[model samples]
Target: MKETPSANKSPPKDDPRIDALIRGYAHLSEQVEVLTEQVKIQKHQVDDLTVDAILAEFHQKQERKTHADSPTPYGRTPPEPAEKEEAPKHLQPEKPHRKRQGLKLAGNIVFYSALVFLIISALFIRTTSNGSPRSLAGFTGMVVLSGSMQAEIPKGSLVIAQQVDPKTLQIGDDITFMANPTTTVTHRIIGIIEDYEDTGQRAFQTQGIMNDEPDAQPVPAVNVVGKVIFHSEVLGQIAGFMGQYWLFILFAAAVVIGLTVILKRIYQKEPKQTAH
Candidate 1:
């Protein structure tokens, strides 16, 4: 057989087919480069648009915030945050009320003290039907039944006298003494008679202020009761009235106690009512 061209022989260097393959590969590479450049440009454009949108959104938000912070039109202001409210008058503690309560408490103390004093004084004072002077605790209480010392110590006046040494008695001093076994007399000493009848006893020459002459007899120092210290007409009348109507004292005390209780209850309830 004739030897045909070797099946594995190399092609010629200037073969048209090889040239065509190289040209096609070059064109494909050029197309890929253009497509990659277009992709890069599109991505840059998208990034720019996104940044502009974000900036616009931020500006709009800032404008809205500024509008909200600004005062309203026509000099009308925006509503401010609400201030804390004060407590109601009734709910709030009042200094004046506290002071008033203190004053009231003081007044109650004074009132009760006065009432106790009056009761004690009424109990200690003794009244007699014969109007004789009574002695207690070195003091004497005498009711003047006569007008012998009118204006100075009128009738129906109560005289308080203090016991003192007879030797210390002075002229022009008012003294109370026993004129007889049952009769008691209060008079001013005009003179002091010393060593009466040589008995070494002192006597007091007595006379009423309103009388025109001295007493019929000199008052012996032994008969002296006390020296007059205080006198009151109103107290004497009150004492006489109470002696006659002793039930009034009980009624008055009961009334005072009842009123005090009612007042205390009222004061106690007032705060509770005000709180409600």
Candidate 2:
């Protein structure tokens, strides 16, 4: 018996083309999710120099969406348009403008505050008694000027040394002491000499960490300043520079004041532009 025309027709097997199309759509959806996350991240970068990059990314996404919706030769229907949406709170024109204006105003306050801070800090760094930067909280800040304790304490590093009793000091303890009436050097105490010449002064043998030979003379205990407690490497360099050129520090302060005045005028104009 011969089969009818309807019986001759076979049911459609699973189509590889359909599977590929589904997979492509799934990949596209993942890419869109990743891009959306990236957009969220970039929105918070307004304070940096990347605001233009964020705008560029937004435009690129718009272009991609436009292209994805274009008609194709595969007889597939174009994607439907997304529903119209009110702007997200962060994306609203008015909110970001207000935030930007607030930031601009804050920048002026910050600049002036920093300028005042530098002036006060430079003055303190320039004044010193017995090689100590300043005495506060029973600690004296001292700036390192030599490579004697290189890599660890480092050249141009600042150390805060606290004044401690000579009896409390021990061999191998780092200390700052006056080598002469006008000179001070910081080194580790290698030897402690007691009862010297009935002068009631303890004697210490000291050596720099990087120096092969000990100091030319022993330091008297009365000259000892303190023990190293805290330090900053880069800040010490800035203090050293200001100490050598205090006049430059004042000139810089004046320049900052002038710039702050100019920026103040600019930020004051932002609100007017957005008033409408």
Candidate 3:
């Protein structure tokens, strides 16, 4: 029997699927090239960051050592170093294992700077109320001045509240509301009430958890700011103190500058130690 001519026939010359596949593969190759370049750039950024971390750690360690060796304002020298029993080589603090003090300080500085910026912006920059905070996304931060909500939402706490519907607020939910022209209060909604004074406005009876009795008047729904979602106590205290006292800001700023200067001196001194 004769073998069929089409048995081993080559693919069709005008196969659209093959042409499309080839184009797709080419596009994929281009994407891969772009992605590889991106990865390389990212890798360099990561390397730079790692080096920064290492240098920061080094500076911090040196700062501690320098301070330990520093003389007092009266020219009194620091305490002499006490000789210590040598630990095994593996027990020593490794480069990668050292504390990330520099990074931590940087983070703190950024955090506080942003907090201060937000507070100042809300109070001074915005065209709204005299001291009303500028909202970011749906959240607003307020510095608690009164001690009514002590311990839980302590005085000087930065209460970061998120906007929520008044009707959705349940009893025991901590809420921030404008009590009067001069003050805003962050208290729990103890009971739902009517706003007889403001006909259209809803109201709720609010109280501080630490207070013996609930507030005498109801919080008008129109005055409800938001529900307390989170709070930053430590940062808030620093901000409050600095804000309340103008001179404290200068002192705090000076301290930070002094610390940076000391660290820079220590970093420069590192080369001399290495040579010795």
Model 1 spans > 4 angstroms off: 1-95, 98-102, 113-117, 120-132, 197-199, 247-276
The worst-scoring run of ten residues by lDDT in candidate 1 lies at 120-129
Instruction: Please give, for residues 16-93, the per-residue lDDT of candidate 2 as tens digits.
Output: 887888999999999999999999778766646477878889998787687677765487665556678888878867
lDDT of each: 0.83, 0.76, 0.76
Candidate 2 overall lDDT versus native: 0.76
TM-score of each: 0.53, 0.47, 0.44
Off by over 4 Å in 3: 1-133, 194-201, 242-276
On TM-score, the leading prediction is: 1
Task: Return the candidate ranking by lDDT, descending.
Answer: 1, 2, 3
Model 2 residue 96 lDDT score: 79
In model 2, how large is the Cα lDDT of residue 56? 88
| lDDT for residue 207 in candidate 3, whole number 0-100 | 92
Instruction: Give lDDT tens digits, candidate 1, residues 1-276.
Output: 888888889899999999999999999999999999999999999999999999999997776667677766786655554467999989988789889999989998998887774564454355445545556688877678898899589998877888899999999999999898678888999999999878799999999999999999999988898999999999888766654555667579779989979997998888554553
